[model samples]
Target: MKKYLVLLVVPMLFALGCKEKKTETQPDQIMVTEKPKLPETVLDSLKNHPPEGMVWIPGGEFMQGAVPQDKQAMDHEKPQHPVKVDGFFMDITEVTNAEFAKFVKETGYVTVAERAIDWEEMKKQLPEGTQKPADSILQPGSLRFKKTKSSVPNLYDFSQWWEWSIGTNWKHPQGPDSNLDGKENFPVVHVCYEDALAYCQWANRRLPTEAEWEYAARGKQKNTIYFWGDDRSKLAQEANTWEGEFPVYNTKVDGFEGTAPVKSYPSNGFGLYDMAGNVWEFTQDWYNVDYYKELAAKNTIAMNPQGASQAYNPQNPYLQEKIIKGGSFLCSDSYCSSFRVSARMGTSPDSSAEHVGFRTVADPEMIME
Candidate 1:
């Protein structure tokens, strides 16, 4: 069960065509742009020199879904399939708060979390006679995790720990009073898909397609439960997932109660850090629960699968979602065991949360002369 309350509000805002402005004086306005394509010459230079915090992932075919015997696997991750992905350069670590701050400071980008909700737009998602939420409740904010008082048997009800905290955004992750003081190196949270896209635009990069994200996360490891391999003992040493009971308490076995600094953990085979945990990263693909089945039905290796053209989740039919790869620090064996390389999740493209952030990718096509 993904959070739906936030999702319900996201599509409405997007439907209204509200854009974030990108001028130095107007930091609160939305800015929108078409996806960028890099020039061949620039791409060639990138291949040789590579970007400062990136690793080259060689192109290849690999198992792209849940392993045959993964009991924890969900139906959406099943029917393992082969996917072929081209080589590309991927961020070595999740984009840090410091990095996102630089983009915001330079571009004056206003993240979705910072914009006030439009009641008129929101009403479109409701029934004919439904009443609107109070103006105060519609204030600009983002979802943040709040530890539950006790263990929750129904892990599906994520509302137990996730709350829409008013005034919560990238600058104030927890609330209005909280700031990114010493956590500059921590992966920036409370960023929606648009915010990530804006950052990518500023950096001259793009979000990885779902196939690329999985391929890079696998890091050349064939059919392993995790990027490091199938060993559970190594999880604590290699990632920042929840160690104790989820929602209620965290044992901090991985030495992090919330998010650890980027690269605090060991890197995967391709030298990518925090690939398993830290934050759920956004991908450039619309999510469809049965998309894998559709691909498997093809019976041939999917050549650079770009993901579904439209989003669909049977559980929440109205909300549009995009595929988000990797799990977050909140992942727990008892709850969301999504740290596994093949695990998949979806959320509204305009929904931002404390457990979500993203990294960028540069495709090989860009370098092809």
Candidate 2:
């Protein structure tokens, strides 16, 4: 089972925006009502002229790991440490299907999910003598989350819900039958890390570093788990996350059964929408379980940390992984409570799924260049 599960290419398979020049502040109990003056070092024109559909994020020093109050934090999210991020511009929302379609139309770029799988390149990551899968199962497709008939006794086994359906691509989110019909405004899913990188390059933007992502997701809030404060009751209203039994029964209390439209919920203090959930966004950094601990041990705040040099996950050290942040609509109290600001998970750089997507960032220096 372990060998086959590892061969599935989905080990656990789990798991931005809008604004402009002004110091993004919303008068609310959760959002920061008043923002501090920007330092002189930050580019004066950075906030003045942002890219279209993008907002300014006045990044600063903040803790970048799971807070003490968060009980659902995994071992990888631990060892809270201070991190400093330079101000940058971020998309107001996750890159929408319409937005991605423009890139595809102009560049004729094809997403990884739209391409056939390769066995020779794949077997390199698997154990020696691993049997290759049947050709029928290798059709261009992706993993789709299919709810179970009833609640399962164990939630640890995610394969019970995730199915590797052939013909599952971005255009066909739930296998070949699904379409993007009215979901033009919806965040594009089934996008791999390489797919995201291509989109970013075309847009003159790049994936945000893990530290920068966490800092901005916090919405300038110092200690709260969720960007909308520590209260779990406000989750349904603040982000598009799972609201029911999960993987079995979804009550759709948040007015969504799957991926909701981008900005379907309230924006964080930084004017970034869907920072807590909706879809997991890819970051520039490689996933390292002990990277936070390494940062904490430095005894000084990390200055615009660029994440670890290499990927490291003791459980799945054989495969390279990249950090994916902000959880997704699949997150729920009963299952993955990863909607919290500091909460994070990683996935293979090559894998794509319905629950995962990405957003991009334009650095101040990069803009100046």
Candidate 3:
């Protein structure tokens, strides 16, 4: 009996020793953690191209518009409330011809104006009773810059900056005669809202939301007035806005009468340029004066909500315009006072003007889970 018990104990001990030896031979395996892979476009944007005239805004919340309850406010600015935004990257300057060209070459996408309009589609868009202009006169085309005025009564209307020219498009800005030769540095004009969208889509970017745009234009400061703060007095050297007597004679005090090169002036606190003046920028949101009230009520954070489901403003009888911000080189205190951080305007999506241009925005996080 004693010998059998000894044998059993010996074997158990041997097995325990073998297990311990095996454990010693293989220590716990180490796991290496890694970050999630980002989309290729997002990674590319991070690589150094050097922002020409732009800034990185770590977006957050801020009071939007003015509350009528507040002593200092306007009818349009009333019912102010907090608006939150996600972080985004915005161009410091309006998109130049050189930048748009890069997008075109990479994507081979034609802008809306560049495409020949389908007569059937045009007819469908027109009001039921409206007569189609004869083919001889019905030159289906897009907006173009006109140094000379047309007989249209609304041509000089600061709001109406477009002229329908047959050959007009981004490449033929003033018509086929005009080219991108010397105007590479100039803000690319004659681009409709759809044109801007196509470029953004190809670049894997988007137009800034109106809320995001205002937040960025305001820079780091909160509740302060202008992008450069509350000072409206025309300082000797400051932002590129209308100076001296507007329209009739711009003193060119700001080194430019028309559009200046991006970053020609000092940058705002967030390092963005031309936030106040240069050319009015396109925003993703549609335009409606009461739209702000709706957004405030709903606390919407949608990147792009179709504006107003329906038109409310009589100024836009046909409701063709969407929101545009930051005023333009043509903005004046005597006329249109949209140079302020909070000011906004809208125009026809199909229209373009010398005062209108756009910048692109990149998503901080391009992908979603």
**Looking at candidate 2, what is the lDDT of residue 265?**
90
Candidate 2 Cα deviation (angstroms), residue 147 = 0.4
Ordered by lDDT, highest first, the candidates read 1, 2, 3
Error of 2 at 301 (Å): 1.1
Model 1 TM-score relative to the real fold: 0.87
> Which has the better lDDT: candidate 1, or candidate 3?
1
Predicted structure 3: lDDT: 0.62
Clashes of each: 6, 5, 2
Structure candidate 2, residue pairs in collision: 17-92, 17-272, 17-273, 18-92, 19-55
Query: What TM-scores do the predictions have?
Result: 0.87, 0.89, 0.73
lDDT of 2 at 254: 87
Alpha carbon lDDT at 96, candidate 3: 92
lDDT of each: 0.80, 0.79, 0.62
Off by over 4 Å in 3: 1-54, 66-74, 134-137, 140-162, 244-247, 297-311, 367-369
Model 1 lDDT tens row, 1-369:
122443333334223433322112112111122234567677567677876888788778898888876678889997888877767889999999999999999999998889877767755644344455556667788888999898788886666687778899999998999999999999999999989999988888899988889988887788889998888899899999999888888989899998999989888889999989889999977777867888888788787777775566766555567889899999999988989999889887777899999999876554343
